[model samples]
Target: MLFEDKYEIIRKIGSGSTSDVFLVRDRKLKKRWAAKIIGIYSGGGTDCRVKQDAAREIQILTQLDTPGAVKIIDVFEDSRRICILTDYIHGISLLAYIHKYGPVFEQTAAKWLLQLCGTLDYLHNMMPPVIFCDLKPENIMLKDDGKLTLIDFGAAYQQHSDVSPGIWKGTIGYAAPELCHGTAVPDIRADIYGLGVLGYFLISGLEPKQVEKLKDYSGHRIVSRKLDRILSGCLSENPGKRYKNCEHMAVRLRQFLRKADF
Candidate 1:
């Protein structure tokens, strides 16, 4: 219930299947931060796998130190729970933003995608290469300063070999087909697929289910030819057919932005 003597819990901000996140404040510095409290299990209460996942999330967050990604400030564990403190971002989730304001403009979507692509590139190029298995509107935060932040590392993994087999660990609609089917091993391309889905959702206000039914974005009048090509490639059913990597996609997106009159 109680965190470190210095941090005071304000309120619960969010909760997931395995953890609950809270808005906490440091008494010493008088600064706010988000703390994720993950329940620890010993013998039978919760699944052992869930505990491993929480530990893994803590490990990965501790390793990552990029501005685009949420920074982990402190980590502690007690007999019953594991607590992780990170910078408190002030703003709304991309999902809430879209629901409130409707689909974003093509130009605005392009800019957001560029920022996300750069972040993904950094993750995929890390020492062991972090694969952000989960990428969706809810996982992205639009800060008040007009920048984006990627949060929720519960599904992230460090790719050790060509294909690491594991259970599917992403949202249904936003996850890549390979990940959903559990037939193929997911790699960096999986994240590319997610980025494509995200772009479509932002520009068209269409969920992944609707997006998947359409053959292409040609039907969407707002989608420019260059943007359409990029989205199509990124959402390819086959991972191999998607963009080579996030960096490759970022380069293309930047080029598109340069030529786009909007």
Candidate 2:
């Protein structure tokens, strides 16, 4: 569909429970952008609630200005839809990369961890900090330049934003147990749990769901405890057992890397 009488839809690139993403091009600028279209209209007239949710995501995007995030270039709204225009990222999902290239090496994982932690730290430190409740490998994109970007923010919610219940929470194995059950309010620990799951999968080349049975490390023997210690805590069923936040987790990572000298 044509939008704003200028942005032409190239094709549908992706979709989510709440919206569909299309690759669109600006006729004047000859630049491409990903437009996430969220339906805000119903049979009667307008779905105020849906519009509110769309606005929430747009608001969160505007506050984000980090390399780890896809930059928001513009926004468009009509009678029936809200379009969030963001930079078109050309990359592979972390999960897809791991499948094709095997688990990332220790050195690579360490570098990636710092980048992710820095990104999350920025998100968590926002004015009304945003929590990326869903952070599985599928949500992270690895660019050709070796930089990682958090591509999906549909589940990101501002801290104490008075959101209604029944919203999308998180994944099963990757999400913190509390999020799985919708028992505890989302916090930094939830993303930490996801980091643990992703880290374990990358290092072991095994599924996080089988983290118990595959009690083995496929990488180096040195990172066995140093990295696993923190990751294990992140996988804890209880949030208290996980690192307080990204800053706390990054400190451990840096300390371990310095000692391991990898």
Candidate 3:
């Protein structure tokens, strides 16, 4: 209900299947925060599994120390609900920013994706290896300082062992083909696919799925032919045909920057 025994709920920012996100402020601390509350599921609302899942998500978020990753400040549970307190990222999300400014400058776009890739690298290489199941632009925030912060760990999962089956959950447009089959488990590469899809959107302003059906992208102003090739490669139908990994993709993206004198 109350945070740090001071901040009160101002209003709800967003809500999902199992939780409600509120924008709160602490007068004593003189800071803003995003608070996520989890409670019992009524009509497929919340349940024990969701509570346990929220706990796991908090644990994963707490381990992050990267700049572009959203910081988790505190976690607590009361008789009424499970609560997670996180820094209120100031500024709009990447999706909103892009919508307002058409496509971001190529250099700025590279900077954003690089920051995200750095965070993804950190996440994928954790001791137990953590996979950010969801990696869409909506989940990526752009701070006032021109830095990108990754948010929403509701779909995040830990890699138990090398042989463990991959999780099959992610947003449809961003989800990899294997996840769609619900048989083959996804891996870190799946995140790459999502990033690839993001790259496609940045260069072409068209989603990967839409690109497949369309004939050409030459009409796009900001993106050049060479850049389009790279985007297409990243969005390859077969994951195997795409970049080897985030590190590899980052390397190639850097090459693009260098060519552009970035």
Root-mean-square deviation per candidate: 2.6, 2.8, 3.0
lDDT for each of the candidates? 0.84, 0.81, 0.73
Model 3 weakest 10-residue run by lDDT: 161-170
Alpha carbon deviation, residue 80, candidate 1 (Å): 2.3
Task: Please provide TM-scores, in order, for all candidate models, with all chains considered together.
Answer: 0.91, 0.89, 0.86
lDDT of 2 by residue, 62-168 (tens): 88889899988898888988889998889898888889998776657877887899999999898888999888887888998889999878788887888544455
Q: Which regions of candidate 2 fall more than 4 Å away from where they truly are?
A: 1-4, 42-49, 164-167, 217-223
Error of 3 at 240 (Å): 3.2
lDDT by residue (tens digit), candidate 1, 1-262? 3576879999999888778999999988999999988887656565567677777788889888788999999888776788889989999999999999998877788899999988989999888888898888988999999999998998888787434454757899888888888876667998999898899899878888897544455664756677879888888787888899888888888888888765
Best by TM-score: 1
The full ranking of all candidates by lDDT, starting with the best, is 1, 2, 3
The positional error of residue 44 in candidate 3, measured at the CA in angstroms, is 9.9
- Is candidate 1 or 2 superior in lDDT? 1
75-184: candidate 3 lDDT, tens digit per residue: 76865577888888888887777677776666666766777788888888997778886777778888888788887888777777322344444677877776665655
Candidate No. with top lDDT: 1
lDDT of 1: 0.84
For TM-score, candidate 1 versus 2, the one ahead is 1
Q: What are the clashing pairs of model 3?
A: 41-46
